[model samples]
Each structure stands twice: as structure tokens, then as C-alpha cells.
Target: MTDVTLSVPQLHEWELMRAGAYGRALRYELPGDDPHRPSLLVRDTAPGSTLTLLDTEATPIARVRVDGSRTEPEGTWVGGVVEPLREPATPTFPELRPVETGELVAQATLLLGRRHGRLDGTVIVVDTGDAHAVSQTVRGLRHDQVDLRLLPEPAAAHLEGAARTELLVHLASVVFASTVHVIRGEAPAPGDGLVVLFTGLSGSGKSTVARQLTRRLRAETSQRVTLLDGDQVRSMLSSGLGFSRADRELNVRRIGWVASQIAAHGGIAICAPIAPYDSMRQEVRAMAERVGRFILVHVATPLEVCEARDRKGMYAKARAGEIKEFTGISDPYEEPADADIVIGRDDADAETITDRVYRLVMGGPEPDYAI
Candidate 1:
């Protein structure tokens, strides 16, 4: 902590806010002026407000006034917004409730941190009428991410590190400077989530169906949902994995690991792979059943239909010299003997498949199977 003092002019800028002290309720001019007209009334102040003042510390602390009469601030002061004491964070914080109209009514303490004034090590306190900015305050008070404290003093001495910022202050400052969106909601229940392993021949609409299911689930429910589509997973988490039989098993196994975690947290995980062997599907099923839910949707589309609808020309390539060992043509697809649900692989209409899986997994009212 560095020690310094403000110039006379900057010192004068120390309103109750900057002075790191609670303030009295009074309406001020929007930009800069005193609002002491006949119609003006200051009842209480709100959080996320700015105030101006004259630094009377050097001059003389006058008798605090309420309305036009002498008053006691400590008695009048209700309580500042309930501010969470923070380390690097100061008083103002994760407030969400927006002040509709700014009418100064009452004042409360705004707690901030200081390099010096360590009263119980407290830095500052601002007066806000009723605490309306709890969320904002909380966001600001979050502990710093990169833990410099973990570094030993000797290690810290040798390393050139960035200046420390309090978690709450830093986050609030960021929200104040940039766009901040706070989204919150509930989650689904156990056995109320779908974990489909779309298995079929290559070009069997496995990825297409899985992608659409993810989109629809997100749109329909507030619950968390994740898609473990084959191609995308291969590129990212399983980048080094390949198409060999052994490699494929490992790849599906990896997907199961992630999916199990997602489902355990009450998220629906939809997996679409050419999980040709029943052994791999069984592994995924065990993982899902142990945690949240599992519904194996076999897109039982026939080989001929899949070959005809080879949109990527994968089947044609496999037949020619261009490609090797494909799922349906060259390799094998051991069908599930006891799949939870099986959809006609030939159909591209995603709604039918989505409804079936949704019902079977969630176990709410059975969706109309009329389709």
C-alpha cells in the first residue's frame, strides 16, 4: 500500500463518497449543483449513486442537518445497503435492483477498503437507503482469480507480478465500465434428462438429429443441456483420437466421462456417435444411470437408406478407393438388443425423434406419439 495525499483541489473533490464516509440524504443537481430549492426533498440515498461535497476536515465539521434543521446522522442513518466486507473490494457491489427515480431520502454506510484507514481493517462506508444492489455488490466482492497469495514470500520476491486488485471492486469496476449480463435459473430433476447416444451407420443423420435436440431442449426448458456431437467432440476434446476400432472405443469413453459430469449436475447430455459396438453404448448407459438419467436412442435407419442419403458423399467415398473402413459398408454396427428407444433412421423430421426421447428420459406426461 502506497501513501500519498490529494492536492487541495482533489481534496475538495472528496464528497462524502470520495471521503470514504457515510452521507446525509439530500437531492443534488444532476451534473453538479446543490438542490436546495423549495420543492427539493432528500429522504434516502440509493446505491450506485455519486455525491459531491466540500472537504470540511481542514475547515470545520459543521452540525449535520436534515431537511433545514439540525439533526443526528448516527440516529437518522438507517443502514447502508447490506455490503459484504471484501478483501480488495470496497463498499459498492453486486447490486441488481435499479433505482427507478433518484430521490434522496435517507443515508447508509458504504463500506470500502483503504490502503490506510484499516478500522477493523475496513476501508470505507457509503450510506444507501435500502440495500437494492446486493447482486452487484456480491459480483464486485468475488475473490481474485489468479492467487498471488499462494506464492511464497521468497518466490514472490523473485517474480514480477501484477498489482493486486480486490475481487469485488475489480468486478464492479468492470461491470460499471462494460456490459454485464446476469442470468440465473433452476435446473432439471434426476431421471428428467435425456442422454441419447445416436448410433447408426455413417451418414445416418446422427449428428444432425443430436444438434437439433440440443437446440430444442435449450429453447423448451430452463434446465442445463449439453450436446456431445461426434464431429465437434472429435475436433476439440478428442482431437488426437481417430477412427480405428480401439481408438473409437476410447473416444466414446472420453465422451462418456464428460457427459456423466454434465448429467450429474442435472444437465441433459445428448450424445450422437457412430458408437457401432453395443459395448460402448452399455458403458455410457452405466455412467448415466449412476448419476442422473440415460435414454439410448438408436436411430435404427437401414443401411440402404443411409447410403442413399449420404449428404457428405461418405458412403460413395468408402466404396471407392478414396476412403477406408467405414461403419456400415466395411465395418460393423452391432445393434442394441435392449435399447430404451429406437427411432426410424430414414426420417429426417427431427420433432418425432425429439418428442420420443424427451418423454422417455424426463418421465413427465407422455408426449403424443401420434407422429
Candidate 2:
């Protein structure tokens, strides 16, 4: 197969936002680094066809890359800019309300808001601006059957066979696609506040930090705080699981799945897991984002310290002959290359680390106490 080359639009990290056709908002972000790797524009320009059209006088398109290894420097990739709006940013995000081709484009507008919280900047159209732009967009989208090329949301034709069936199903299900449902009777969805994830080696004080932070969230704000600790889960939730890589992943997935349920119900999920792998972390983050929110907090802990506090002597057992595939000892731990907030990454004590996670999570207003 010949390699195809495409010049895609540039994407920036901090200065990006997306507006759905249903008036819902979508924030453009990568799982990790490269501030400029998630662009929303591409040029498959053709005669009487324009690929880049401005919906309004101003629109914003951004670029970002997935989270990478913690030890490596942050960087972005350059791929063709056309990607299917995977699962849709929201329900009305892709199909556009009333479900039609042009509707998505008309309602989908990228705003290049003024730099640094300003909204007076020039807007570059997101996906062909209108009908003319859509017609022009058909150029690069040229494909045979089984084509996987990405197109402007508005250029998408839900009129196809499969799409049509899905549309009918969706019609039968009267729930709005872009609707935001608060979690439980308390927890706030990403639409409510920031959802931060806590990660570390076991005994690295994840539960400690989660406990202290929850205390603050309860005292300071009315936000309903919840704890999904490892031991608690290992017993009730993941009882049948063991200490294998696959088991660990399954456990983490269950944790994320439950946490997503919590965040979905509008409550915070202060999770404490040895979430020893980057892929697992990314998977959880996607789960959180797919709904509305997810924040990653790496409780950087030293192996020596964790081993010292082995309280349960699991580390000693692992060092002996009783343990297999222990995280940070036998099994490889893919340290988070890029995380939203880092705590105790550099040998900070439990008390200090607890303070940092608390500040990062709830923003420091509680009675600063040590673990």
C-alpha cells in the first residue's frame, strides 16, 4: 500500500474549545502531551468545493496528542486531520438534531476565542462552513467501499443504510443525545466540577490522600465526595481477581467502570489503585471523558518508602517467594509520562503529599492535617 501524505491543520493544547450543534460544549484535549496535536480542520479541496469554511466570522480548531510515557518529553504527532467524531462529542454532536447531513455542520462551530480567555479573535471555519464548503469537502473524502476517512461532522450522511437504522433506533429512544445527567443524587458530573483521578503504588498513600481530600470537599463545598479504595474493591467488587497483569487490568477496568458510574451520577470518584500501567490509566481517562470529566493525579511515590511502609508485608512477601507479578517489584510499572497533577513524585512524605493532592483536587481550604 502506498503511503498517503496530508497537510493537516495545527492544534494547540490550552486554547481550544468545541461547540456542538445541540448547544452542548466539548473540550478538545489529548490524553497527555504535545500541546498542538488535535486539529479539527483538513483540506480535501476540489473545484466548486472548499474544505475549510468559517461557520461564523471566527471559529477555533485545536490539535493535541495522546498521553505519552512519563519519562519522555512531551511531543505531538502529525496525522491526516479527518477523524470520525468517535462516538460523537455528545448525542446531538455528530448527527445534528433532526438528524441530517448538513445539520451537524451548521450547528458545529469551532470558536478560536481570544487568546487567554478572550473571545474577540478571528475564527477559522470548522469543517467546510456551509453547503458550498460541504460540496468541496467531498474531494479528499473520495473512497471506495469500506473507506475509513474522517469527514466534517456536517458532511456525514446518516442517510446511509446502517446510519438510517441507528437513527430509527435513536428516534424510538427519545432520550436526547447531548443530555447531561448528574450522577446519583449528589456527585457532580464533569459538567459540575473537575473530576481528578488518584494513582500510585499501593501504600503510596492514595487512600490517605483520597481520605484527606474528601474531608476537605465535604467541609468546604457541598459536593458529594466518595471513596473507591483498593482493599474495599478487592473484597466486594473484584473478589475473584488475583495479582496477574490481566487480573490487575480487569480490576482497574472495573474500578474505572464503577468510577465512571459515580462521575456519571454526579459524584466524585477518589480512586486509589496501584493503576500500574499507562494504558489502564488512559482507558480510565477515556471512560471519564466519554461521559464528561476525568482528571489524573499521580501520587509519585518512591519504591523504598512504599516498601518501608509495607504494613501488610506484601512487599516483604513479594521480595520473598510468596508473591508473583507485584507492581514496582516484579511487574513493570509504566510510570505516568503526563498527568494533570503530580503529588509526592519527588519523595514527599505522606502528610505533605496529602496536602498537595488536596490542594490540587479541592483547592485547599480545609484544616491542613497530616495523614
Candidate 3:
């Protein structure tokens, strides 16, 4: 495979991964002894599209690239030396220093505004060697009402399909006020795309309702639907978590991160977690609101009915003291004081329940069942 070297002043530590962890190590060459210095060389290995980080010494320390399967970074092949990148000099951003130019662009914009009045005319230019990064930066600035436009690099055009989809989150999270010209047309406005949160007890059929709702949305509408079911997320995103309150909250947060990504990209995220705490659910709601719309659906199936519907024998086990901290049995399932939609345990079919959720997602009239 052919390798092309590109020079870069700095790279975000979270952008590169090593054995499932981020923050790559770097070695300085003889003349470049100042670790705080900004520029470095990147060796782009073709055929696999891997980006290798070479220090001033020209020694390979780390290799990174956007993983096609995930919006987050993955581990890379590399040596063991690590160093921090130099902070960019932004005279305007004294309160909020400019860091690496990427997805968190809007966050930096907000920080700057909070410390130094409203940023009505602040212009932020981002060149991260990727068009998606530029699009995301523009969108983030727009979200903060920052006036800006993207200056696209010729080499960064013609991104792959997966890379394009991955960049949509950045674009969605940032740009809304100003226009950005892309090979694929303009950045989409953060539309009515909502994070529909379904919170209930362990046996409350929350996951089942979410799955049905997802299917209905996919079949009936042209919009994309991503379902983050509790059990499945526990296996993948929250694999190491135990059933403790703190661990459970962390699990919900992980799910929130994924849902936020989906919501930011103008898609519907149906999350069905046995979220027993209202505070944690509120946290997830805030996360979604930063990028798109948020809706909470409380599956109000009673405890007795839920226990009766528990096919996994979880309720029985919890009652027998085998399972500790089981919601509705041992742990408390805090009901939402204010829910957008409440699904009561009645003879209503799955279609009826799904229709109710779809209505809420589409901003339809408030259902009679809402509390």
C-alpha cells in the first residue's frame, strides 16, 4: 500500500484510539524538542486508509482513522510514547481556548460566549483535513448563533458513504445559522428528529413497545429509526456494568450518548431503558436537546402486571432475594412527574401503543392518555 505524509499542527487525543483507549503517544525529533510545539507529520497509509502518526524523530507512535462501524473512535496499532498537542492561539477566545478542530466545536463556541458576551459576529474556521469535520464545525457554530461559513479543502471532497454518515452528527450538532457547501448538498437543519425515551420497570414491556414503535416508524415513514433497547445495550455499550444504581445511571448515560448521535443526525432514537430514576432520565433528555428534540414516554404498566409478564423469571428471582436491587421489587422505580406520553396497561394492542408514540414523535396533538 502507498503511504502519503500530511503535516498537522495538532490532533485531538480522543480522535485516536489505542486498545479501546484514546490519547495517542508521540516522540519528538531532535530539532522539535518542545513537546508543546503544534505541528507534526501524518502518514496516510492507503488501501486500508489508516493514519499513522510520526513524531519529529520520524518514528511511528500511533495510527488512527474513523472507524466505519461506530461514531466513536476505536483502538489503533502503535508504539507506546504519548504526548499532548499544543493549544491553538485564539486571541478572541481568551475565556474559551481553541482546542483541536472537530466535533466539539460548538461546545467551545458556547464556552467563549458565556465568558465574553454574545458571539454575534465571531467567525471560526476549522481545517481538520476532513470535510465532515468542517461541516460539523459549521453546524455547531450555527447552533450557538455564531456567524461563519466553511472553506472546503479540495482534497477532502468525495468522502465515502460510511464517512459521510459518520460526519452528519458533527454537522447536525453544530451548523444551523450559516450555510455550508458540501459535495453532498447543504447541511440539514436539526429538524423534528426526536429522542423518544421509554422509561419503566424491568418487566414493564418497555423494550417490547420500543421495538414495535421502531418497526412502525421504519415501515410507515421515510425517516430513519434506531432502537437502543436496554438488554441489548447492556450487552454491548454497557457490557462491564453491574446492576447498581451508579452503574445503571452510567449505562443510561452511554445509551444517551448513542441516542444523541442518532438524534443529531436527524433520525429518531427509540430508547427503552428500565430507567428507574427521573434525574437520570432528565440528564439523557438534556443530552438529546443539545442536538435535537427530546420526548419521554413512560410505560405505566403496574407492578403486578409487569411481574406477571416477566418471562425471564426475573421478578420471581427478585422476590426470592436471588436478584439484588431489582426495580419494582427491591429498587424503586421513580415515576416521571411530567411525561409527554403515558402508556397505561390496558387491552390496547401494540399498534395502538405504537401509534401513540409515533404521534408524540411527530409533534401531533397530545393524546388523552398523557399525564
Cα RMSD (Å) per model?
A: 24.2, 16.4, 14.9
How many residue pairs in model 3 have overlapping backbones?
10
Error of 2 at 231 (Å): 0.9
Query: Residue 81 CA error for candidate 2 (Å)?
Result: 28
Candidate 2, 196: how far from true, in Å? 2.6
Those runs of model 2 whose alpha carbons end farther than 4 Å from true positions after fitting are 1-190, 345-351, 363-371
The best candidate by lDDT is 3
Please provide TM-scores, in order, for all candidate models, with all chains considered together: 0.46, 0.49, 0.54
Inter-residue clash pairs, candidate 3: 25-81, 25-82, 29-56, 29-57, 136-170, 136-171, 139-174, 139-175, 140-174, 140-175
Tens-place lDDT digits, model 3, residues 250-294 = 788779878977877778899999888876787788667766789
- Candidate 2: Cα lDDT at 83: 25
TM-score-sorted candidate list, best first: 3, 2, 1
Q: Give the 10-residue window scoring lowest on summed lDDT in candidate 1.
A: 147-156
**What lDDT tens digits, residue by residue, belong to model 2 across residues 72-146?**
121222222222222212221233223222211111112211112212211112222223223322232222111
lDDT of 1 by residue, 1-371 (tens): 11111112122212222222213332221211211111111112221222222221323212122222211321111112212111121223313211212222122112432112212211112212112222233333333221000000110111122311122222222212122222122222244444667777776677877887788788888888898888888999889976778778778877886887787666788888788887678777766765567777777888888888888888888888567668877788889876766776445477767766666655665434322
